[model samples]
Target chain A: MTTPPPHRPVPQPTQRVVVTSPRTRAPRARRPYSGTREINEQSELGAVYMRTLIRAQRRLGLSVCLVTTGVLALLPLLFSLEPALGRFRVFGLGLPWFLLCVATFPMLLLAGWFYVRQAERSEREFAELVERP
Target chain B: MTSGYAVVAVLVVVLGTILVGAYGLRVSRTTSDFYVASRTVSPWWNASAIGGEYLSAASFVGIAGLIFAYGPDMLWFPVGYTAGYLVLLTMVAAPLRRSGAYTLPDFAEARFRSRAVRGVASVLALAIGWLYLLPQLEGAGLTLNTVTGAPDWVGALIVMVVVTVNVMSGGMRSITFVQAFQYWLKLTAITVPIVFLVVVWQVHGAESLTAPEYPAFRQDTEVTFNNDTMIHAERSLAIRGTGEVDGVRVDGGFVLTDGYHRIGQGSEFTFPKDATVPHLSTMAHNTNESWALPESSGADFPLYGAYSLIIATFLGTMGLPHVIVRFYTNPNGTAARRTTLILLGLLSVFYLMPPVYGALGRLYTPELLMTGQTDAVVLVLPARVVDGIGGELLGALVAGGAFAAFLSTSSGLVVSLAGVLSQDVLRLGGVRGFRISAVLAGVVPLAMTFVSTGMPVADMVGLAFAVAASSLCPLLMLGIWSSRTTTVGAIAGMLAGGVPALTAGLVTMFTDTGDAWYEVLLSRPAAWTVPLGFTVMYVVSLLTQRHVPPGVQRTMVKLHAPENLGLDGSGPGSGDERS
Candidate 1:
């Protein structure tokens, strides 16, 4: 085998350093910074990035959806399995009414809030990775 | 009801919409502005606009009516409707925005590189748009007839003309602001009335509204049948009124036996307090408890129907042409996702108000059950519950809100339908072509309003959702996620899913059927059709792997990639990297 090429160390900038030179290093060619943009330019990189993002999103989405749909589906089953459940009331509102009408909104909102927070977090992580040298 | 106040309210909304459109026209100088407001709509504003357009007469008037007629089970309508956005936000919103296509058909053509797929998508969009539009027109007619006693067609005609004019004048730019404004207006109109009505209910002594008995008129009530009505009396009904009953002219004090009785057009029936309210013959055949209990409502296959409705509304929202088009207004994928998040809140708040109206309607406006015009319960409740000028004012507010709902949603649908019609079918371009398409879009649905009768507004909207869910939901999901989706597979999936759903929708719309399994199957096709669509697409795509679009890899990257990445996301194989 031929001799291997030498590895070059990546330049690491220190936070404390403040270079005030007017035109140091020819402005560094204005490289694209966004991770998404980097992936967009490189098809192989893009494929990996997309797979990760989609997988995370789909996993989170499916979990939330399954939970929500489970509750909704179980409601009728609960009623059928235990007829007395329908008669069960909280604050004079029937259990089904209270659950389906009044309670469902907050639950759905919470689910949405959870989803948005998680999704944005995933994006932020991806963005940070893309920004790293 | 005071026709003058209601008419004034309606005129204010119509004129306001027109003025807004004219203003948008003045500002919209570029084609980009007309198509997507230069893709600069903020999340909150776009969310509100989406909420405005999404909460059509179905949500505004029909949900309340359904709850009143069918009880607690109908609560699913609002729940399903609101949750639909959650589904959209999770699965489709970001990718769809990143696709950067102006319409659903555009997305299809871009994804599959198949004009045939685009053609089918265009037809489905038009069909779904029109199907959705029919209800807004019908609701307008119903509202006008109830509030002003105008002939049914006049209200539909007015709405059609106004929507067409607005769309032709300014396209989507004007509609964005108008719809966003209308969302707040609608929320206030609905919420304010409910606050007063609920206070009134409490002050009048909040009696147990959940007594397990059929509804009884709380006070003396007069019901006018605008069209011929068949009422099923559980007990003999003694009425003092004038007009024709069962083809006999009764001056006063007519008795309807415990059976079906026909009340002719213009017939008026006055019922005494505490009398059991007669049920509409159309709906009375089913067993429903007075308290609108969940399982006791005697819906045929309630579980199946409920699950199907959930499937349709949840999966179906992303496929609505008007709704999907709004996603294109977002500046980027992030904004699109943010808009959906905000929309969930807006829609949840708005949905909360309708159930209050529905519950109050059941308490105070039981006579609607007899007229089978339960959908008008939301309009009539404010006047019935509140007293004097305040009542009239609240009634007018509700009227204004209802008109706004009709106008905003119908206008959105018309804009979307016109856009597709102009681009695909008419093969026309520019503003003038859009104008002609606008007229075509509005007139056909307006004509449908006259031909169809007796179908509840929400049910009609549901059929539209089913069709959308069956066809476009599969197309959108698979197109974005799966690179192996071939053009043949896409076409096959759409036909397998859409045709059956469409046929079912058409059959349900045009024909009346007894309580049969086939009828239920046709009426609620989403449960099966959606699955059928996915299965066909998946299996066919697997079999025809060789025919997969050559550029799907790049397209997938563009769709899932962040907009900041600067990939060429315009279409497949056009990967011009923007620095």
Candidate 2:
């Protein structure tokens, strides 16, 4: 059993090594380290992340809004196209009255509920991705 | 109706609001609390407060009045008002909360990084606040005049004083509790009467509710004109009346021939039970037989007016200074979003009751149509239907609710307006500055109400929405989403959009040009002005790309990033990222 000389360079397995300046070190691979601050400090990464989040959020918002808007916009047209529908009554109330006055609100609430759920989910996913270890 | 009960009810509401304000004052010790309730309001409380403030005199009484007078087409007002939150929930709520800006002007300065843009935004906010406040004051005057026989100015003055004092004393912190309590108070005031009214309708056979033709007086009715009124007659009819008819001094019975007939002030007219109600010239389209018909009343281009109203209300809520400022009270972006979701529910439940009052008013208070005082239907219907002490109590409840609507909304507006005025215009940032701003914010609108007469409360509110939709809506939508939007583009867009809208609103307010095109375009400017605003913003931003704010990327990151991601997302400039 012989001890190796302290000055003698030990032969180690060849490993991949890329030269990098200490001033611009590779990003840390940890959950808290790679959160929004790191992403923000890295301007290019922040821009990409922000753009993607915005695009996703915008798409979700527009789709929900489109459906709601279409329904609202079509209401008058529907009544005009079929005047009888406006005259149609349910439970002693005029159809138009029932729809616009009573039914419209619940529909709005449902749409709002859907939007909140989807938006929160999107944010959650984005957070998870950014905070991945 | 007994005036005593109504007077008592109004006094109670005024006192309640003051008490709530004082309670809030006890807790609000810092400038932050004064502006954003120290950014600690929970979602439920904030949502309730928003509901209290957002349901103004327009929602409390005007929608029902419009529906009773104009029929089904007016239902769009409530629908548009409530659905506006959906737009806010999806696009602006979370990001706006994340911006950490207390007022619309704060947001403008932060996003554009330009004091010039902030100045423009502050001016627009003040204008919109004043425009919105005008209707609440007028509606208060109208409600008081109807209930207690007080001159219109008394009610306006009462509301103005109460709201100004509340804001001046405690600011947003105190108003938050006052508004939240008012929301529930308004709901109860509106809902309880509605239930009884519905039962009354059912007992009365609901026959008038389903009237296919023009509404008729169910019994011999005598209507006294408090003010001179011009009514449109569909066909010739003879009426027993006194005072000037169509400018002729009639001592006895007179025949009101076809076309327009003017009824002099203090004139009394008796109509037979089955005679068709003469439509007020102000409510032109309502003369048609079918109640279910979707015709626009008094609007030159009916379709355009309707669509413009829808667009204005749907987009305008996000831009409202008071409503937007409430979002900043939420603890975080998620809470803001949650608050919006809750607001939709609370507002929907509250809105469902107004139309019932309208339908019932058409049955019991048809005389309102002739007097051009349809707005009085809510205050008058309970007594008209229910008799004795019960009726008086119900009427008082409604009066209280009406006052609550006026107080909560005006207080919120004054607070937001004062915040912007002090922060941006006066460059003062203390309780004293806020008080001074409060007086300025409230008094101008109060003065305007005196000069402006006969404008429907709902219609006046619609004008404010048009201005907001044209100006601030474009700013918020572009500022949050488009990183390329420059300060020059923002200022240019706001001025180009807001000035024209404001001019149109003022013209519509002061003049009644019965011409179709002018009425349609000027009365509902949002359809054009909003698009113009967005286009100008986009084009100008493209042309002035070099002037895009330097911190835009960082701001975008702050706005879009999740709060739990451990980033400094709640500020204007992003902090350094050092691990």
Candidate 3:
């Protein structure tokens, strides 16, 4: 995010007074011992490193959530449009029953397993990048 | 079923929960803290604890009841409930724990740095917890009413007193192991009976569930209608009864016509073996063929109903007050994530048992449809299908398990709600604050059950999820992922989404406007309200961009970064290089 130059505070006549400038801009990127020091003190460079980690993790979470929920959401419409599909037997049980009751659990577990693996991997990669000598 | 065994079972479950809470209370945190937040209990044990706390009255009895009354379409309930944890695992599990706030309100205040947002979050937390607790109390009443032929309020009072005493006494101090013990107790109570019941079903020739014939009583049966009920008979039938039908007293034989008939309160009917059963008017009159198939939920918009239920449940689990507290038992972010995944497996195995009871209830307990006590299917089915003393023992086992579900879930809800209530509302700090809040929490919902119209227990639980999905879900999702959310936007988004959903849920519960076109919309508002909350929060935050929290960067670091990194905006940086 681009930090704005400081501005004078002005009280609004209609509402409560609001601050014009951010007090949270990490005291101008002080020179520090390491990246850890930079982050601990909240420098611009430290914000960059933190943003990278957040972006990677968010993308992983969004993709997994969307794909799994998106695919499952189509089941009700499928059963409605093609009535015969719901009736088709799978292993001697109705397909809708088989899919919704039996098959969905393992699929959810598999998706969760995939998410954990990827999330930890990215966290590891970020640590290695930050902790370099 | 004999009342003796069932009565004994209920007493044992009550005593068992009390004993377990007392046992947990006696052990101080240092020794018992092994499995609590201090890295003593491993992730799997924590998962079981969550499972214990979560496999509430809804999963145990309500799912099976709804499925029995409707059809296979109700399978979505179990599916959605499990998938909620999956969503929690993928999205909120790690980051939430890393945020270092034990409750949802804490997350709001920490993120927004505004008391206004925290106040709004606290209100919603209390509202959602109370709404969720309402059904657990109702389910307890229903179970007791069925088992001992006691009044509906007696069982509810027992649960309220027992749980209130437990929490007030601080017996749930080390709740992790106690909750885990509850999970195993509920699992066994539900599982062992299924094996025996299924074996009995197979021995009875595994009769086809999808057969075209209407369900017929296997032997001569006598039915008593304790409350006034309108029933629908598919064909003309002769019935023997003593009570009012069509406002005419028939002390002897009467012919039930091919259409609707009102069986007056306290009426008893005796039917010959192989007589066709007439189901209650509230039920969708379905033959075996239609009921076993999907999309036969008998509602006008079955598709919309299913989708709404899915949306509410899949996103709502993270917003629950009690569920959020369990995350703290884990030592760090990764442990929390692992705990959630193990919970998914635990929940999946428990969920599988409910639908089994539902399917079998359609066969052995078709009379439940006639009596409009379909929610009792789980408790009554064991005795109906299996014969002799074995059935009595198994029925007693199911009764005890149902009590376990009610006690575990409601107590968890009360304790967490009391936590929020004391800190936010009562402003009390010590044990005395918690005690007052706990009593108030139990008292408000128990009073509610006395006046409630008593809808099916599962559907009541779903409305609680709807409220969470509409209000708190947005706050958690937006507050975590988007740093630009401002104080004004947080308040506006919660009210905009929460009011409409909460109002709709309340409207559905207290009043019934028969077959209104908007009935589905009113009953299941999550399909629209969830997106409404998310959009309002995002758009408002964008408009009020200048009002973003000052310390958002530090807050983000605290939430998203691993704890071991020491980037928590504290003084770890100064000593880090030397160490």
Candidate 4:
């Protein structure tokens, strides 16, 4: 036994039908660019993305190599030009011994660390650019 | 020294390697597993393996001996070796890893799409690998002979057997674990002995290593010339010994002249305390002050030689087939860079110990300078500095470590060389083929050691580096970084740089070229060869610009892109096939 619903007056709603076609731009979904596909297909657009990444990495690598190894390559000339540097005491050891044996290791590690960080960052940026919506 | 303890130590290293490798064998069932552990290695694991393999006999024994004989200038060897990883990290490590290469030749083919380029790379890789192996074999013989009085061939034989047994049982997957374990063993073997030696040094009244006076016999010393030695004694001295000098036996007191005297094999000489030490004729820095200085030792064109050594080691590291193959074992490009960075740290720590041993040897083991067996300075220093049982125990630890170095390096080279031989040469693609190739790889180098004239271990290694830097370094540098490289340029560059450098290195190693003005140029060829390789590659590629591979755009993208960017494996731009 259900009770009868309360009676209420209802007003008619205003409505209009607008004509539209399937070819309307508003109905079509925009597709995100897949740089990955272009690169895979070896398209011109894909080549641009690849070039950007390769260029950035090559520049970082070249500069780092120059800064670290380029300077080191000059050391033999320095030692030759200033013979006294071979015997000058540093930390109770000859300068050459201290520099080559003790100092050079840490310096190499630091340079490597810097290069790795830069390379990772560049690769990350590349991934982001290619994958971005 | 103490052959009993040393023998025990050597046995432990050998047996331990075999057991560990057996464990690796269980996981290795496929061809990929045999070649590169299926590329699943983490940074820390691969880093340790790289360190174990990279610090060959050159770093373990050769660098210390060179430092002892040639003085501080020789410290450049350790420095250049460590710096090489830095060069690798900045330039080649990640790109090479992302290229999906199994070996250096695989990389060449992928880049150039030409069989001819791969052929040249494989040949150069084999040449460099064999050249590098010669020193390790030589050093093994030297170490065994120094500690155990074993025939020189005995140690090389032992190393070959142990490594082959291990590889036969497991392949690279087992070798990786064996090598990683060896790195720590080696570090401890060198480090622990040095700590006690330093304490002993301080307790013995802390003699100055850089003193102005020449090294003298601190106590009455009995010196044995294991190899034929030429020595320079500055003053007449009384000596009592049983041995041959100038091929004639002398068993009693004799007045040694002020000039050079040649001592034959099995010769023994006992020099009194405070007697001026007869110096090795080839190495002439007798005064501690001079020995402590750089560029004072008698290598001709010292500046050019040092610079050439620098170029060869720093650039050559990436091109080493064994070292290159190890990078391919990294799971991806990111891990490859991470591995190299960690490797730099591991190598730096180990390198510090060898130089310390060298410096201490100057004060304690000057007799090594008299005998040309300075390569054994690291093995001898621990026992000489510490006394009694403790010294003997330390000596054993070092001996064990030395064997570990030879085994790890040999295994790495054998794995890579076998990979090339079985896959490229024999066209055999299975675990059985790789196993057969492994044995073949070891035999060639072992046989070559019999014929090649032996140089000091570090010097031979330097020649290998020069060859590698001249040839493969150019190909990797150009191919990975530039898409313009053509097949003709690649082949041309490898031969131009490699052939002349190889000829020079062979000439230096096999033929005697004494005191000629041009001898230094031939002996230390990297100063010329590296530039030639890079220049020829660049210029020829530019000239043959239209001959570049049509698929190069895809290859370049594949090489330079991050793995997760979906550029992994054969096809790029495919839906995520991350497996």
Candidate 5:
């Protein structure tokens, strides 16, 4: 058998070290993020930059998710405040009610939809970048 | 209900899961493979595994029982459970996958760079995992006892033995296979019996018997909680079967009656019109009124506490140790994200079936709730709806699924606990330590099942959510994305959040005093404890932000950056961007 593509000197076998080096190169990635201009460059390096941009955009989506969920979680704290809107009065059970009926679930559903959209958008861009090669 | 075939079917399912795991032993050569399946599991497989682990015995039996006992209100459990994934998808799915950590504790150590925080997290993880496992073991014991008339311990022991072997032999790889298989088992178990039962009900021309036809069917039941206190339960309860009321022959006829009991402030009970039943004693709270469902039944409280619990489950999905660890088996974050979406669909399909059981429980067995047989509503459902061999077969199928649910969830929890215990608690640094920790993790809960027997399964699960939400949730949320996280803050927050929950949970669990403080602490602790934990972490983190280590920037980059950016120095630029 031909010498199996001379095992690229894998400097260290420790999982942590292997994962860290590429992490340091992350900042260099920001250099080519001039929106569509970077995409048009069509160079391999340009593809890499676009990939990085797609990733940053995805990270942006994640941040939005955090903010939304953070706010949503805090929704209950708002209701605990006295004199909210609406009440839960089914079968003579007079309970003070608010957004949970019309708002909480619907808001959650909306948030989920927005998140799926962002994730899908990022996935499509990444796929385009991958196809460039 | 006894069938040799039923016993064989259960054996086949259990043996099958263990055998699958045993078969995976060869692939688990490395420590990484043992813990996370070497980061190569596909989205479908991972989702299946998640679904398998997710459909626990509680979902199988307890929820239907809860619905049977509590009317339509119990439907919230399945809804909340399925919805929790949406929260996870938006907030945590990809970031957690990219964290490149093995367990939740690993995420804390990486994020806060604190061995102390890691230590505390490990302790909390172990505690929660152990706490969660006790119910699973108890459920197993209850299940086997119900199915075969076997001793309760035998069920716990059988599951314990199979799970230990499965976990030790293959780690996540074997578990992935076993769990996926279990999802189908759980689904089939739930669906087949339901369909068969519906067919049987149809044959009996159940349509002739409307809600108005039952003898004790009342237009309204005025539930007066005290000698003078009164609340009207406006909805009618259709009492099934034939009975003589006021010495009159009545087979499927109607009436309205008053059933009530006095309960102190912040107290909850189930009052029975007929005495000797448990849940009929309505849990009366002397009126902050928030403690009891508002005069609106459950229409109060924005979303019901049941829904709040669901929201926590959905958003809290990412915080779960067992659920998150499954993502590590994927090759990258994209796969992990996709796996989460698939999990949503799987969870949705599976959830559709619980309500049917719950609805049927309402029609066939109304007394289950009153007698604490609410837990058995799903278990005995087949016999109630259908007769003979078909019922026995369906029961066997459900038994197998319930067992599968127990094994998958228990093993996943055990694995997560084992990882944390070895890495942080015992500080057992290698592969050998992991295996030992795995076995030790399961043993504690197995032991606990023998000591504790009366705790309600649903309530115990709620306590687990509260503990997890209070402790790990705040820590995980702040640790990632927040540049201000510090070791001292994480440690302090965990203690503040975790200790009160642990104490309240223990008090609520071990004793039946039904004290007001217990209700405040156990039922609504999240409102106070969660804020306390966050406040401590936030304040401490802000104070310590100035002293952040030079490596903090680098770690953040690793966390936030893309996958393919080779960490090599080949990128045509500069220096190590150190502080």
Candidate 6:
């Protein structure tokens, strides 16, 4: 409208204003993926929580393993001595009854429960770790 | 009276299993399906299939036979076999499922990136498969010859044909269904007859048990050597008299006499000279005997041996070519874990039954131990205690179940071998190459069966475990847990561990050392070989750690991370996901 020259206001190359001064450069160098690296580092905080969970799970498993081994060692002796035990029954059962019922079946169930729960927990923790912000 | 019924039954079970397996084949379009049914199998189904495959001919006939011949000590086989699964569940099952490999050879290649290691694994898998297959074929021959008087070769041929048909048609998917169904059949066959036989025994009571003679003069149970010679060992038994041993009567038995007490279904016995030797040539007792208390040595050995054997079996289960392939059928690692747990349950329950059989054998078939028919113990049980129709029906059911066991396990092993073979060797060509490779894989074993002499099936299975424990077990455990494992270490460990286990097992098969120390070493090689494998892997890994590959850290993260985390995700303290 005012008959400006061909390019009209070729804006002065905006004063080359720089946030970082030449004399005092930034303390941290710019990483290739600054955003992603920051996010990953932040998410690592969750690792401690996950580690605790995993440690507890492993402790639980080791405890059970030791107990089960002890029980298995004792079973053969007890079952062998059943005839000499004088009609003794743990709960309304004979020597065979105690072995099959109280000992074998129950122990198997408990072990199975432990495995299922631990597997699930481990998987859940893994998923949580992956999905973290 | 109908001779053709047994043959027909064999055909129906074989064909039916194949047809069902074919139905499963429709869903198998990818490599995953061919190798592991895409990993979606539920635990119940997987457990059943595992049960089906786990119960080999040895479990069916040999176990009962052993129980019949020996006393309760023979129960160790089943107990150890099942307990191995528990060890697997706790230690290696989930980790192996996460390995994402198709076969043991595949795992070897991935862990060490060494063709040499893989070659060793492939050869071992093939050898063990073939060695195990021999007993199965022999069992089929024995069953056919014993039950229907068919030629032994015919029985072997029939099994080979049926197994080939099922395996070739469906691969892993098809076999999965076949094995699951077979497990149920096996359970029913065993349990139903036992119930009926017990009822018959209780009803018939003590009368049918004929007392031969009190304190029949002591007899030595002797084993034949090369059919031309004999070996004798002194044995003492509390003579229950010449009672009905498997529906047969003895001449004298209130007391033990120096002779083979119980012969065949229609046979008699007389005291023979050289009482230190088992039944003399003319006398019928060709089996051995010992005081019952002395024989139940399941507790006698050091616990270390027991624990080591259990660990070997448990760790070895994950490495078994046939068993590991089953996990490939599952949809994810979670399902694989569940499947393992279900397997544990099935194994535990089924295993309980074996000890009962062994205990019962102490009362019935002590001679089985002497004759080394421990594998046939399960098959002969019903007939011995139950009479007439019930026993026949039970026997038939057990036959079907035993056939299932042999077929499922053999097919699984063959498929694993074939998978590795086709991938590595046959890949040079195409589909035609694959077919040829399959045939070659099977034919070698079939030939080997003809050449192999007889051995106990349980012992053969145990040797397989020992081999697996020494080689594949260490590779897997270290590959999953240790960061420094190098290709060289793996190869060295595999060779060092594998050679000893195989050598000892084979030696035990061909030679019988009179010395107890020599006998124990030949029978149990795991005690030495497992540690040797671990040591080799660790030493080699440490030496090679400086040249660790770039992807190791990432792979470690993936391996150690939780399931929900995408494998691509960065671990804690990892600055960049890509790095």
Clashing pairs in 3: B34-B40, B34-B41, B35-B41
For candidate 1, the share of real interface contacts preserved is 0.31
What pairs collide in candidate 4?
none
2 against 6, candidate with superior DockQ: 2
TM-scores vs. true structure, each candidate: 0.92, 0.92, 0.93, 0.94, 0.75, 0.76
Chain A vs native chain A, TM-score per candidate: 0.69, 0.70, 0.73, 0.72, 0.43, 0.42
Question: Residue B425 CA error for candidate 1 (Å)?
Answer: 0.8
User: Candidate 4, residues B1-579: lDDT per residue as tens digits?
Assistant: 746899899999988998888888787765556666766788899999999988899999999999988887788899989898888898899889877687899999889988889999999998999898888888898889988888889898888878777877788888888888889999999999999999999998888888898888878899988778889987767888888877778988777877889988888889888887889888875688888888877888899899889999999998899999888778678889999999999999999988888888888888888887889999998888888889999999999999999999998888888878876777666667777888988898888778777678999999999999999999999999888888888888999899988999999998899889999889899999999999998899899998897678778877888766555324553534331
DockQ of each: 0.16, 0.18, 0.22, 0.22, 0.11, 0.08
- Worst 10-residue lDDT window for candidate 6 chain B reads B222-231
Backbone steric clashes in candidate 2, count? 0
Question: Native contacts recovered, in order, as a fraction for each?
Answer: 0.31, 0.42, 0.47, 0.56, 0.07, 0.15
Residue B150 C-alpha lDDT in model 1: 83
lDDT (tens digit, per residue) of candidate 1 on B457-560: 99999999998999999999888877789998998998889989989998888777767767878888889999999899889989999989877767877687
* Better candidate number, 2 or 4, judged by TM-score: 4
DockQ of model 6 vs. true complex? 0.08
TM-score of chain A of 4: 0.72
Best by lDDT: 4
Mark the regions of model 4 whose C-alpha exceeds 4 Å error after superposition. A1-32, B568-579
Which ranges in model 6 have alpha carbons more than 4 Å from their true place?
A: A1-67, A70-102, B1-8, B22-32, B206-311, B361-372, B425-430, B512-516, B547-550, B569-579
Chain B TM-score of predicted candidate 6 relative to the true chain B: 0.81
DockQ score for candidate 4 = 0.22
Task: After the best TM-score superposition of candidate 4, give how far the Cα of residue B66 lies from its true spot, in angstroms.
Answer: 0.3
Please provide the root mean square deviation of candidate 1 (C-alpha atoms, Å): 8.4
Winner by lDDT between candidate 4 and candidate 1:
4
Q: Write down the lDDT that model 4 would get.
A: 0.84
Task: Report the TM-score of candidate 5, chain B only.
Answer: 0.82
RMSD of each: 8.4, 10.5, 7.7, 12.2, 9.2, 12.9
